[model samples]
Target: MNATRSMLICDDEEELAHELGEYFASLGWHVALAITAEEAIAQLRGGLAPQVLITDLRIGAVDGRQVVAEARALPPALCPALVIIITGHVMHNVTAADLDSDFLYVKPVDPTEVLDDIGSFLAGVAPPPA
Candidate 1:
């Protein structure tokens, strides 16, 4: 099996996006970083499909929901197997369980925890601790 994993990280925080990109790349994954929602959507429309997608709840111009929707609309072969949503905001109407993503994480999350969750997903094991 091809273990060449790929990931796309969409975050409005340029520093955080790049940091996560670097972390994933160092672990032998193809990493794409988008500091804006438009850039991320464009990448997806341009056929840059990844195995995993990590997006912030609120990003420039558009929100993470739009980004995730774009990814989900892609052909099955191009859709990400795992979609992780990270947000610092407490939604007035939506709770964590209300998210339509594979995993929902609040902000102030550690990179290691995200990594572990991804690992568990890929290994077909249970998800990591909340």
Candidate 2:
């Protein structure tokens, strides 16, 4: 059985967030989702830091980059949470290094592919309790 892990999805799309959260939950992940940057920050402040953080690039006013930057500023162990981005936004000159995500996938992406990437990333990473 796949070990259950926690994941956070920060997307403003209500239906998409629910769909992805349910899909990942079905795959044995404990999932939580936030619809905006402020809400996401609240979740984190409320001690909802998951093993992975999946966010949309253009969430709210601050955007995903700001989200990552804010969260990544935490203690080293808590900072740098493995982040993934799935956006329809056009990113002409960007790299993961320029953002807080370890994986960058465009919208219209397959859920299975996202899960597969998460699984592989988790296999190599030690999910912290931080």
Candidate 3:
């Protein structure tokens, strides 16, 4: 069994958030779901520091960049090991510099690819072969 890693997923889309949460949970990861940016920030400030945080860029109010800023503001040991931003508005008013994330994925992303990246981040190694 894999070591139990913790993850925080913040997405306004209920279906996608739950899907990602379930997938990570199945991989032996403890997952937390936040549907709003405020909730996501609250989780971080309330001592729910996870190894990974995956958030949607355009969540209602506060946005993912704010969430990342909040996470980064935490003490080093309390910060997430990786932050990933996902959004449908890839061509919208967003630039790579604005992301401030370890990885960014446009919508319609393959969950498996995200899982692979998560595994790699946690393991501190390259992703496994397909």
Best by lDDT: 3
Q: What are the root-mean-square deviations of the candidates from the true structure over C-alphas?
A: 5.0, 2.1, 4.5
Tens digits of per-residue lDDT for model 1 on 28-108? 888998988899899999999788889998886699989999999999878888899999886677764466788888788
User: Between candidates 1 and 3, which one is better according to lDDT?
Assistant: 3
Model 1 alpha-carbon drift over 4 Å, by segment: 1-3, 92-97, 125-130
Task: Give the alpha-carbon lDDT of every model.
Answer: 0.84, 0.78, 0.85
Q: What tens-digit string does per-residue lDDT give for candidate 2 at 96-121?
A: 76675799988876899888887787
lDDT of 3 by residue, 36-119 (tens): 999999999999978788999999879999999999889977788889999988567756456788888899878999988877
lDDT of 1: 0.84
Model 1, residue 50: displacement in angstroms? 0.4
What's model 2's TM-score?
0.87
Candidate 3 or 2, higher lDDT:
3
Model 3's lDDT to the true fold?
A: 0.85
**Candidate number that wins on TM-score, 1 or 2:** 2
